[model samples]
Every structure is written in C-alpha cells, then in structure tokens.
Target: MSDKLGITPACFTKLVQDLRIHTTLTDSRFIQLEQKVGFLLQALRHSDGVRKVGHRFQHSTSTIAMYIHEVVEAIMTSKLYGIYVHQPTPDEPTSGIITRNPKLQPYFGHCIGALDGTHNVFAVCSFDLLFLHLHAGSEGSAHDQKVLAWAIEKGFQIPGPVKYYLGDAGYTMSENIMVPYRGVRYHLREWIAGARSSSRETLPSTKQELFNLRHAQLRNVVERIFGVVQRKFSILTGSAPEYNYKMQAMIPLLCAFLHNHVHINDPFNRSTGKARAARMTMEAKRARLEIIYKRTEEALQNPAVAVDEEVDDPPEDQPEGLSMEATRNEISDRMWIDYLKYKDGPRRRQQVPDHLDELLLAFDHEGLLLR
Candidate 1:
C-alpha cells in the first residue's frame, strides 16, 4: 500500500491516526477516517479519478469527493503549518547544497529557502472562469511577478535583512529576495553548455555571469521542491482533478503542505540511506568541480575581472522602493570578490582533470548526469 501510495506505511498510519485524533469528523457519520485519508492519498498519488477512487473505497463518487474535501480542509486547519512551515531564525544552521560547496556558502549564506511559482492546470467551466477573473483575478494565467505583487500587497511577510529566499530572474531582487542578473545565462542548461563547449570563450565571461551561475545553483531548491511534489502527488502532474476553481487552487497548496510534512517526517530506510550517500558524493564532486574551475580561471589570468556595470532604476510598481537592478549589481560585485579570494587562497585536490570537464558538465539542470 505504501509503495502504491508513494508514502511509507508508517507515515500513512501516523497521518490517519493524527487525523482521527484531531479532525472534527465523527467516525459513525461517514466512512472511517483511515479509509477517507487513504482514499485521498490514493487519488493524489495515482491521479485515480473520483469514480475509480469511489469504486476502490466502496462508496459513491460524490461521497468520495465530499470526504476528500473534508479531509483536505481538516488537514489544512490542523497544526501542519506550525509543524512544517515555520520560518528559520537568523541563527539557524545551514545544510544541504549551500553547506556542501564553499563557493555557494558565502554567496548564499543568509538565504533561508528558494522562492518560485509554478502553474498547475486547473479544470474550470466557462462560468467559473469569469468568476476567477473577477474575484481571484488571475484566471489561472497570471504571471509569477504579478502573483508575488499581490501577495506583497496583501501583507505577505517578506523576509528581512539576512533572511531571504532565492528567486529567479522573473522576480525583483530586494533586501529579502535575491534574483538572478538579467540578460545573462541564468539557467543550468546554459551553464552546462558553456562548461562542456570546446571553446574556452563559452565559459562565464563576466562577474554578472558568474553571479548568475551561482544564483541559479542556489535558486534550484524551489525547483527541487516542485519536482518532489509532482513525483509524490501524481495528481499535480496530470490534468487537474475535475474540481471547481476554488478547490483546484487549494489542491496545490494542500499537496505542498503534505509534501513538506512527509519530507520532515520521512522515516529512514535503506533506500533513503543510499539516496543520501549518493547525494553527498555528488555534492563532493561538485565542490571539486568548483575548485577545478577556480584553478583554471586563475591559471588563465583573465583580465576582464569584476567590472561594475550601471543598473537601471526600479520600476514604479516595485515593492518598498526596492531597486532590483541595483541589488543585483551589489551582490554580483560581492560574489566576484569573494570568488577571486576563494580561488587564490587554497586549492583542493581535483577529482576530475581540467581536460575531462565534459564528464562534470554532462549533467542537466537537475544535476542528473547522463551516462
């Protein structure tokens, strides 16, 4: 059941037990809480249509839909947010990719998490589209920046000072948010191509280029979050469930919250141990690659170092008088200086030769290297 449902059996049992203890639903009125939760999980994990879920649960499709909605609402109203989504304090310890790479540590030392918005297809009737356009206002076609602006306007707590989330170029860089430098090779694909190319000319040529590369590296956390969410909840990857617009909006949010819950409470197993070991090995290789790149750059003695470029002023709609262009320039300058110092100070033993760079560059954006 856990294998089919994409969660550990213990996790499923714990979730059901928690919901039974906390939910307002009485066991006598509807199906058992365990079955309700199981049905929802199966539907989410397999994208099993409501009809199929109803058949599996031995209930009517409408009953299954109602119970699923109730379960989602109950979970949302529970302590999931408090348990999983708490903001990190300044003194919180750094881990994961940032800690593994020295180059990334100083550059993204203060970043708490990565921020990015992904669109999920929602099934909406023509009448509901009008309602969404007028009330929700995005009509499922809104830009990431626009959604961010709305959140800011609605008093969403933007990070302050040293605490921030790494965003992509679509967002405006601010005191609490960092974005990639505009008009640069920002994506991992572009960086991989440059790294693998025979021409040394294809490598990052300017301070901004280097900054963008690092920015993309750190900002990828959000992409990984999305990937895991989709992999765990196949309903998100498939066409949206036949729910109404409002319910459709809640689906992703619910899945995200559940995803975080599962991640935080994941029970260790042999597969998990193997995956962790592989990840650590990959991070070590990446650190070595960074060292090699630093050595190569230093050996080449490239004179076109860290030139400050003029950044345009912020647009009128920018929140809190934040100048994204100015923020990017300042951070880029800092990164350039830090990288130069890192390169000149100490050399780690290279894991791969400079001539065999393609072996390292064969990976795609997600760090999954091709054979």
Candidate 2:
C-alpha cells in the first residue's frame, strides 16, 4: 500500500477520515473519495502523464485530471493545511534542539528556527524537523536572499525582534537572520573525517571554526527535511509535468503538507517499515547507503539544496538596526570561554567525531528522520 501511495494504510485511513470532516470531498455516484485520493497519490508517486495514469486507473484522462485537482483543492483549502504547515507562535518556547542540547542552548537560545531555500521551495523548519513556514513557486535560479525578501514582503513574520533563523553564508546577516562564519570548515563531512584522523587537523581550533561547526550541525535539519520530501514524492524529483505553471507550483506545497502529516503520524518508522528493509539484500543496502551519502554531499554543495553552499562572507557593515554580526561575535566569544572552561575541567572528551559520523550514518538509513 505504501509502495503505491507513500503513506501507510493506517495513516491513509486516518487521512481519509480527516478529509471527510475537514475537506469538501464527497463520494460521487461513480467514484468515491478513497478512489479520488488514490488517484492523487498515484499521480504524485509515479510522475506518470495524465494519459498513462488514466490508462492504469481505467478512467479517462479528463476524469483523472479533474479528480486530482479536486483532491488538491480539498486538501489545500482544508484546515489540515494549517495544522500540517503551522507556524510557531510568538510565545513558543525555545526549540527542543536548543533547550535539550547543552552545547547549543547557551549560544542559540534566541533562535526560532533554521531558514533555507531548496530548489524552488523556500522554508523555515524547527530543529526537530517540523515545517514552521513554507513558500513555493520561486524560480529555480532565484537567490536565497531574494526569495527570503519576497517572502517577507508577502508578510512572512520573523516572530520577534531578537528571534532569528540560522542561514548559510549566501544570506545577508541582519538582526533577524543569523548566518554561519563564511570561509570556515562548515560541512559535516570535513569535521567527521577530521575526527577520524589521528592528527585532528580538521577539528575546530578557533572560536569561529567551533561556531561554524555547531551552526552546520543545527542548520542541517533543514537540509534533511528537504531531502526527505523529495525522496518521498517522485513527481518532485523530476522535471515539471505538463500541468500549467500554477498547478506545477502548488505541487511542492502539497507534498510538504503530506510529508508533515506522515512525520507526525509515523514519527519513527518510515512509510515502508521493516518488511521492506528486510527484503533488501546486503549489497543493495550498501548501494543505497552510497547513494544517500552522494546525495547528501551534493545537497551540501548545491546552493539550491539548503540555501547553503560556501561562499565568500558578506560585508561586515550593516545598515543601522541590523546587528546580527555583532550578535554572532558575542555568541562566539561566550562559546569560546565556555569551551576553555570545559577543556580545563576533568570531563572533557574528544568523541565528537564519532558522534558526528553516527549522525551522518543515521541519515543514510531508510528512516533518516528518526525522532
């Protein structure tokens, strides 16, 4: 069931029930809501043309097209959209990643989430992988900063004056936008490989390096979320279909809504559970791991993947009222001071590389977003 729809039967059943209550979907004399949803999912899952999809479903292409659009409208206009793509409230507490991770809490307590642009989608996600905000339909070649500016003009709230989102070097740092130290060792693989080396040459030695390392780790959640959605929906992985540009633009948002639904319901296990994993041969597993790693590396390097790819740092000077640069310097200084005290203490351990590798491996597996 999940193979065809990318959603488990149990969750699908629940979703159908919700659609009945929250959406305007109703059973027709010929086709029912379940079948309508099936058409939508199948179309999204396989990326088949309307004619091919109609042939497979034994319906005319016109009927399939109408039903798919109906389903899209039902879901998009439904209350479920708000629930799945919810924004954080102003009074929302610190993200779990910050409050729970001792290394991050002190420095990033003011952070509301991470922001990045992936392909044609611009999004802000909390550290725990929840989609806090999303804007789709931007041109593929649009710069991250430009997309962000457009979103803000469209009334995308920054939540508060001090609260900000972590971005990569490509974005202009401001009071509400915190970016990593440019030209520093920021990618996880660099730090992980350094951890395995005896010389430890890649390990962070300065406050900026350490800050970038931590920034990369926390900011990685946005990248992983983008990867998860693109992997789950086949239509998103390829070129745009023949649909009109407006419908094409809505596809990413539709997938994001469903992705959030799956994440909330299936929290730990993937849509395809242990049975699928068990059927895989060891060689296939290794092949999949390599592919996952390759994709991760490509995502890190691609400017459109997470709005993150290394670039020369932006100028230090900011117009009045924009001072995230100064804020970052203060945080780095405090972090360095804490690190010195910790290193002098008896409990210091150099196991961060192993921990980093474990995180990388976890994402390589089938269920990368495990809690």
Which one is best on lDDT? Answer: 2
Best by TM-score: 2
Every candidate's lDDT: 0.57, 0.74
Candidate 1 pairs with clashing backbones: none
Model 2 worst lDDT run, 10 consecutive residues? 353-362
Residue runs of model 1 more than 4 Å from their true location after superposition: 86-96, 120-137, 153-155, 198-202, 267-331, 341-371
Tens digits of per-residue lDDT for model 1 on 174-237? 6677676677766554554355444446545679887877676555545445555677788876
- Per-candidate TM equals 0.73, 0.83
Q: Measured by TM-score, how close is model 1 to the native structure? A: 0.73
lDDT of 2 at 130: 76
* Residue 345 C-alpha lDDT in model 1: 53
Residue ranges of candidate 2 with Cα displaced over 4 Å: 188-196, 270-308, 312-317, 320-322, 347-371
